[model samples]
Target chain A: MVTVHSTSPHFKANARRALGDEQLQRALTNVPGGFIAKRQHAKDKLPEFDALRDEARDLKNHTLAHLDVYLEEYEARVIASGGHVHWCETPDEACRTVIDICKAHDARTVTKGKSMVTEEIHLNAAMQAAGIQPVETDLGEYIIQLRGETPSHIIAPAVHLNKDQIEADFRATHTHLPADRQLEEGAQLVNEARQILRQKYIDADVGITGANFLVAETGTSIIVTNEGNGDLTQSLPKAHIVMATIEKIVPTLEDASTILRLLGRNGTGQEFTSYTTFSTGPRRADDPDGPDEYHVVILDNGRTGMIGSDFQDMLRCIRCGACLNHCPVYQAVGGHAYGWVYPGPMGSVLTPSLIGVDQAGHLPNASTFCGRCEEVCPMRIPLPKMMRHWREREFERHLSPVTVRYGIGAWAFMAKRPKLYRLATGIAARLLKLWAGKTGRLEALAGAGGWTRHRDLPAPQGPTFMAQWKRRRP
Target chain B: MSAREAIFARLRHQLAAGSSEQDRRETASARIAGHAANLIPARAQIDHGAQVKLFIDQAEAVQATVKTLASHDDVPDEVTAYLRKHNLPQAIRHGTDAQLSGLDWHGRAPSLTVSHGPADPHDEASLSHAVAGVAETGTLILTSGPDNPTTLNFLPENHIVVVRAADITGTYEDVWQTIRATYGERQMPRTVNMITGPSRTGDIEQRIELGAHGPRRLHIIIIEN
Candidate 1:
């Protein structure tokens, strides 16, 4: 029932198209202007921020090391709290399980919060195919859903859109509203959406959400959102279905707090989101208002393969999108250029791991290896190192394009012999310098159009780094 | 094999260390039961009075309005003033939460009409009593029961919460400890809502606009005497 559609194989074309899109370029400015400085300010305010990151990393590492037992314990707790736990090995199976649950409840319309896991499994399409309406309650998600496009950013789903584009989309879809009504300001758009969705939340039969963390100690699923859509989505419906991956488990509330310290500060630069709701199970006997049935579907979807692979550390990702915020490669081309469910440095490593390097090889190659992603990662994931691992895999499998293979082959041939490497680099540096003709930039390179197409490639100012190192040391 | 078993098998197979299954179970249980605290922010390790001041400062920084009253008895006066100042409805929807219901709203402000139960669709404002307030993030912790229905937190256009100054703690860890003690070991209320500021979204061009879906205004009443 769930089909994963990917354009990763055409990542180059996607990146090129994204670069030429003027509206996207305008929208992308929000990345550095908004996220980077906010994260820095939040980090600077707390003296123990780095120490908490270390604790968060250690907690995830410990949890992953004994993942099986911890998951077993977590399931038992969920059952004890009067919640159903469904284990799924694939996205299709997870989708099928959800459809069955909805059918059991005779649900016609299901409201949803912002959940990356559901996006990963393409839950909306599957639900639509089954004749169920999946209403996105999050303002960002609702905008993109109206446009019939996938999320371009993880945390900010509609970040790639400008106000004009959004206003146009609203006018086109919300025909019932006054056609000429003012929707110029951000608050106006928000208020309009609130008025429209308020009735949908009350009419929804089932609500599906993604958990930020699942506590093994008490079987609670927690969601942190600046908007309280996730709370209303789950609280008003007859049944609450939680769609989550297996790796989202933590040991206790204390551990969740440790990670929370980093998640908001690093992700949105807030101390905490507006609502961090912890739901244990179905509504209790005396509860006046809440869902009667609670179900949690634990998905694997090839992540179990990552458990012991070189990419196992990727499981520690909390989907903060800070890497996307800090990644230069991601900033230049935007997330749509990455061509998948996830798009960033973390995606560069993870996309290939989930869907083979042969198909997603361009993702790893997209990085500048500035090491900013790893530096900013709250979980301390070595993203550049993992991307390098994928590059090696791509080369070994002979899946890389022939030109890239030969370029690396020739470079490796020289790199092995130190004298020849220095000689070859020295000659090329001088050739490039001579070709510059005092302009100090190259308009184009013969075989590497990708390097010089957007901006002039800066000419080497001096000899190769190795040659300068030897001269200075000697 | 069942999907659950297969998934678990693959995980254990991939992560097959030398430890026995029993050993891993022991480790997990010990960890869950221990409920150990990690490195808490030094900002949260202050005295109660400082914590209270920090709570107010932190809460206000996030755009939540905080007003401290001498006692819970003065809550009705402030609520009426707030509702009138904003020109909101002369009524509020609230739950049967004792701390809120026990207040003398009828006597103190006869002009203001207050009702109880889960939130009504057209309600302009709602009120609740927070179990605790975390000073570090200026977040209020509300447990869902008949006392404070979860819907009251998100269903209205404006939300008002009253927290006793004594209940405000310095860290989320302190709140967790209190939860464990009140709910009994490893048990919790059906829902525990931790609210910070009001509803907001940066989804539109990354410009944060308040009141995306929930309340636009979050007014906090801290009883200090």
Candidate 2:
């Protein structure tokens, strides 16, 4: 069982530790392993990629606007197709419904596809506490599961570890294998885990997966994956459960196609994932294979409040992790430093909404506002704007520190008076130059010791911009 | 209140009924019923021969093997040859798909054994007939039913799919249209599996290793009938 003890409030502390950890720094260096280049290649292949992104964003907006109608229609179709739809307003209800389903079948073992929603709800812990052995079939999720850790990255859960770390994990867990077997390469580790999980797939009594999109037109739940773990997890089990949030619902299959064109290309830079499965319900009576029972659980959490609010655009997110891949902050600190299930720009905006700003105010403040996340987003979500919104909410709610409030208040005070602002900036620039000496840098400072502790801050070299402009004109 | 009712009520309250509630409901239902295609890529708009070429190119780009045969009778021989070349067993598990059942396996590979129905725990290879092939991404659409068992597509180490040349379409929109015509717009099979290549994972240090859980090798046999 994995527990989400979020260290989000201690983001600065986590980041400080992460920066100095040699192993983590080495792992983080491999963060840009062909992701940016591959995404560019995929984009180059499809000229309509941007146009498709626009359509996708608009489609999501339309669907979310009428989410109630689409959800209702989707529920009816699922029931008509011999499946059950369970609406859960909270994570506890979602976990209870899953456990109840497993208990009804007396499931001893349950296999799972990679699902962030399940991560958000901490379903594995609840299931394990109920005495059900939940096995993560995805390669990345499986590694993290063995280590009893949550995912560091949304797409690549184990991206924070190297092959050596994974090899050690495999050796420590798989005792049945021959001693001193050469488990050095990535291929060898993948093969070992594949052989170990194949038996678990057949042994499981129930399987739970997350839906990439739910089609209200045909009551279909779609999942896109490069590995076929999700298919095997759901197909072999006696009962299959799809755990999804309400925003996952789309109006029709065509709406799904609009987004599908962008999902793989943006995430992994593949034109399409190896497997894009659309499962409507349980197996037919005449079918030779498939789960006999199918259930769909729709969790709301706080998404219902997101609609018609300032944060509504954030709902267009497809969980592709493109923003995370391109984020400079994520590349430096890695995901765990963000201190939550989600990290990077998307996490910056979403974590606060899901877990309250007071608990996660540091996340929105962690960004450099480089806008790379927004530029690369398949849905074109205004991530920086949303982060700014979260900052505003934090400030309004008095969640920001006193120092930050005082600094802002002082800056706002002079900004209204241009003459005073110019005078203060001119004086500060001269003082900074005097303090910098020949090095032209500030190795230490009185008020902001935290900034200069690790690296020297560049001193202001000349007069302020306003002073220079006035002097040149005169 | 029940969770469902509460959720709906909250959403309604948040939406605040900007327009007539009846109008919003109608608009939602209308969009689902219409289900129009939006922004079909120009790459998938080529002619038939070019479409097949594009499909083959796309499939190969994703690390899948393709074989074009003049008839379905060549399927068994090709399957046997693939197995022999790879040092795999000459056993294939398959479902009741008519296109697959009509093939003469005994004539081409007399020593090969065939298992009918879903995949067993030890099946080395499996065969299924693709309902349609999308040329845009070289995606094989397999609708799950008695004819094509869902398990056969994922459990085996090797997967071979047979698709009629006429069934290969230009885009996903065309395939969706065919599905709508056959199963109605509001209905679908229990599972519609769109397979582009064999299973692979980039989890271990972001390195791609084929056959993570499903078939390590994906072989496509397109009948040019």
Candidate 3:
């Protein structure tokens, strides 16, 4: 029902297209400059911020270690609270389960909160195929949905769009409204969206939302949002469905709080989101207004494979998009270049695991390894190290291109004999110095066209670092 | 095998040092029942008076307006004044909480028309009584019941919440402890909303705009006396 043109295999071509996209480049300029200062300010205000991150990491580690037991406990608690849990091994099964639930409710229209898990499974397209309208309530998501595009950024789904592009999209889609309605500013666009989505929320038969955390203690699903769309989507509908991965479950409220401290500060630089709603189950007997039925669809979709593997640490990701915010590679090319639901350093490590290494080989190779993504990650996920692991896998599987393999092979062949390696590098450095003349940089180079296409490669000043180190020390 | 059983089996199989099923269950049960508090921020460990001040400061820091009154009797007049000052409609909506119902809105603001129950699209303002306020981040914890219907929290242009000074605590952990005592062990209200500020979104090129789908303005009334 859903189409995924994974350009991850064509990462080079995708990156080139992204570089040429002026609008995307304009949108991407906001990331490195915008998020860094805000995160720093939030971190600086709290002295115990780093300590909380450590606690968060430890809690996730502990939870993952006993995932099966914790999940069993969580399922029991959910059932006790009058909610049903549907375990889905794959995306197709998850989609089928959701459709069955919708059919059971006789739902014509389904409203949704911003959920990356749903995006992972392409829920919107599937719902549409089933003759159900899936209305994205998040302003960002709604905009992207209107454009029929996947999210470029995790938190900000429409981060790649500019105000003008949005204005045009609104004009093109919202034909019922006055075509000349002013939408010059972000405020105007927001107001227009609010007016449009308000009626949809009330008319919706079922509401689907993603949980930031699923509490095993009380069987509560928590969603943190700056806009209250998630609340409106769930509260007004007849049935509420939570689409979450199995890894989202946590032990207690205290643990949830510990992670909350890191999530808000790192993700949006808020002490707390405007609204953090914890929903346990269907509306109670005393409740005046709420959904009558509650259901949770827990999808595995290759996450179980991540457990006990070297990539298991990835399960700790809370989907804050902090790595995307801080990743230089992500900032340069934007998220769409990575060509999947996730993008950036975390995506580089995760895409291979979810889709396959052969498909997402370019993701790991795309990183500069400056280590900013890992430094900024609230869960302390060793992202660069994981990317290296992926690269190793790609090479071991012979997924790397013949040219790259042969280049590495030739280098390795010489490197094993220290004298031969030193001689090769020494000669190359001297030849490059001679070719440089006064400019001291190569504007063009044969066989290294990819490197020279954008910017000049700096000429080597002297022998390689190994030669210099040996001469100085020996 | 069912998806659930198969997934669980795969997980246990992959675990490096898989414990007995009983051991795993006990560990999970102990953690849940214990509800142990981890490292709380030193900032939240403060005296009551300081906690109140910190609450106000934190709330204001997030663009939420704060006003203090001596008692609940002053609430209706304050709400009327806020609506008039902002040049908004004098119409408001609220839930049937005793704390809110006890306020003499008919006597105080006769011109202001107030409705009860869940919110609709046309609502200009709505009010509720918070179960507790967290000082650590200036968050108001509102439990869903007949007292305060969850819909009033959203679907309005302006949202006003009245919080008793005594109910405001130093951290979210304190609020959780209070919830346990109020709702009984392991039972929570249908929904517990922790609201720090009015609705906002930064989805448009990462620039924040207030009142995306909820109240544009959030005014908190702290009863200090």
- Top-DockQ candidate index: 1
Model 3: per-residue lDDT, tens digit, A327-430?
87888889999999999999999989998898888999999999998999999999999999999999999999999999999989997999998888889889
lDDT of each: 0.91, 0.92, 0.91
TM-score: model 1 vs. ground truth: 0.98
Q: For candidate 2, write residues B106-205 as lDDT tens digits.
A: 8888978988998898899999999899999999999988888889999989999999888999988888899889998698999999999899999987
lDDT by residue for model 2 over A1-474, one digit each (tens)?
123457899999999999898888888776686578788899999999999999999999888888888888999999999999999988889999999999999999999999999999999999989999999999999999999998999989998998999999999999999978999988899999999999999999999999999999989999999889999999999999999999998898888998999999999999999999999989988988899999999999888989988898999999998999999999999999998889999999999888888889999999999999999999999999999999999999999999999999999999999889988888998999999999999999998798899889899989888767878994
lDDT score of residue A360 within candidate 3: 88
Q: Assess the local accuracy of residue A156 in candidate 1 as a C-alpha lDDT between 0 and 100.
A: 95
Per-model TM against the reference = 0.98, 0.98, 0.98
Q: Report how far off residue A393 is in candidate 3 (Å).
A: 1.3
Candidate 2 CAPRI grade: high
Best of the two (1, 3) by lDDT: 1
Instruction: Please report how far candidate 2 places residue A36 from its true position, in Å.
Output: 1.7
True contacts kept of 3: 0.90
- Candidate 2 residue A442 Cα shift, in angstroms, is 2.8
Worst 10 residues of 2 chain B by lDDT: B15-24
What is candidate 1's lDDT per residue for A333-419, written digit by digit as tens?
A: 888888889999999998887777877899999999999999999999999999999999988999988988898989888889999
Docking class of 3: high
The candidate 1 chain A region of ten consecutive residues with least summed lDDT is: A1-10
